[model samples]
Target: MKTPTSPIVAPVALLTSAVLLTSAALLTACSSMGGTSQKFDQASVPESVRVPAGHKVAWETTGRGLITYECRDKANAPGMVEWVFVGPQADLWDRAGRKVGTYYGPPATWEAMDGSKVTATQLAVAPAGEGNLPYQLVKANPAMGSGAMQGVTYIQRVALKGGVAPAMACTMAGKGQRQTVGYQADYIFWKS
Candidate 1:
């Protein structure tokens, strides 16, 4: 009593499915490693990192660093509650490969070799990807340190590579376990 399906309909459906899949694959490829690299766009920066009416990018540096994750509960007890991102401790370098500064986060700071440092608190966040670390937008201000970071207005973390916490399970008994993953990013400093 059921009508037979049309042979032409099946082929059209298959072709449509293939095209959709192909489009998805292309999008994923654009965001994947060895596919595309990240670049800074001033207009698109997070609100916290966006410069005020007149200020411009005063300085920028590229850094090679590691993001540290601690497996601790809410009360600082040494068991796996969640993979809390402690922050990054990285060595900053210039375009010519010269060591320029260092970045430390969670109490986010950028310190230059001459002892100038700026610290900021995150105001916004963006996920770089599921497997990669999240990018942050911070409001930076002068801290104890001197030179490069003294008068900074903001700091933006972008172009994240690696740094996600491991999938390893942490039990309640495994309280003090700490994991550090390698990552690299570019930090842009805005100043008037």
Candidate 2:
């Protein structure tokens, strides 16, 4: 004979399981929302591209998009041609996978959704690996408009993939041609 409480016991157990699963998911979401919770080991980064002492991570983003290259006459080489980098056009996303801003330019710029933006000067670069763009460090110019990008001091480009110039022949016939290659990199912003 079945006890009166047996059906109640099964429903209670199912409810408890559902609550536990929801709690775990919420915890995971909360952890990822704090973008800086993703570890950035300074020691692993080349010193040339590392942020200096006294600066802390202000924002971390993953940039994904295209880098345009043009086939042009090699600088100072009268008859030789080569693929030259034009600029990058990329969307920057936060750790939680939200689109936060954009990176583009002849003057490399990072602009946030709130209208604040910054232009940076390249400070240094180190080899990332074969077929990958080099890691870079840049000093941030004073941000304009005062939102998410305001007060940023430096930016580091790491975890590079692709972005190199096209491997095709840059001959006289190909001169003036342009091509875009896809790339992804992590941009870590720092504040003093």
Candidate 3:
């Protein structure tokens, strides 16, 4: 024999479940909206990726990284990056979220973790985000690492966000101390 309350219990349980599901969805949506990826604009992709009249894009790498600076004071020069250490080191990840290589430079270089590296020279520059370095067009030297970067003709660093020179002026007193700042940018690789 069915209890008088069984039918009522079923309906109430269904309604409660519906309410909980709706609330969970709303929270998920809100959390996604707060992410940094929301601020990224594809249209703002740096022109450093563009090649000469006939060339095309060989490959492109997009990733976030730290703009590392070590405390440095060279001869107490006028207004140099006194807190400069090795060029920044940024881990470059592929679309699959796998770390395939690293972009580290001041001399501006890229190294594939698998075993290849290339150095690039800045050819042109334009400003990017508030605290970031300038968007730069560069030309890469031959690849030394024997990996993916071989035969890379041109390289560009652009859409940078946060790789600024150190805030405090580096002095002889502060020499040898290291500092790392957070930064993100797009690295474009072009071949001849």
Candidate 4:
């Protein structure tokens, strides 16, 4: 009774609805993590350490030395969250860049500064209790990315030892005041 196009249209409509529903669900999940109630004890940072723009940089003391926290705005495209780690070679960056890992929502891709895409083996998030990392919503050019695109709020986080810090050169496309991404826990280590 129905034409071929009629049946096709029904499936197409159903698919479209499904995509919308999935996107909404993912967004809800990411939003639940972004809250201001979370807090962390202050870390001792040297007076000479400079915090970069878009970077909510902070540090705290443990016992001997200290560990630092640096978080950029959230890069909440329709798909997933991405972070840029720039510091020592043995930390999360080097370990994660070598393997391909999958998340619940989408497949994550890590790219190097030279345009080569690296595989992230271990994607470990902080907020070390029993919950997901607090994530804010942001947007950016999908093809170009945070450092290359305009008109998007891309979030990022990096780990640093001692005084070494990540690069602070990324193109941000928004006029809103930046806020602290979330609470974090860092392991402090002393230089030998």
| Backbone clash count, each prediction separately | 7, 0, 6, 6
Best by TM-score: 2
Task: For candidate 1, write residues 19-42 as lDDT tens digits.
Answer: 999999988965573235334577
Question: TM-scores for all candidates?
Answer: 0.69, 0.85, 0.64, 0.23
Q: Considering summed lDDT, which 10 consecutive residues are worst modelled in model 3?
A: 34-43
Better of 1 and 3 by TM-score: 1
- Deviation of model 1 at 185, angstroms: 0.8
TM-score (C-alpha, index-matched) for candidate 2: 0.85
Best by lDDT: 2
Cα lDDT for residue 6, candidate 1 = 94
- Candidate 1 residue pairs that clash: 78-175, 79-175, 115-146, 116-145, 116-146, 116-147, 117-145
Report the lDDT tens digits of candidate 3 across residue range 1-192: 965777688899999999999999988876664432433233465555444555455556665777777775555665554655567778886544567788776777788877888987767777776677887777888899666888888876765777887787676677777777778877777777
Task: Report how far residue 180 has shifted in candidate 4, in Å.
Answer: 33
Model 2: how far is 14 from its true place, Å?
14
User: Which segments of candidate 1 are over 4 A away from where they belong?
Assistant: 1-40, 43-49, 74-80
Displacement of residue 37 (Cα, Å) in model 4 is 6.7
Model 3 lDDT, residue 8, Cα:
82
How many angstroms is residue 123 displaced in model 2 relative to the true structure, after the best TM-score fit? Answer: 0.9
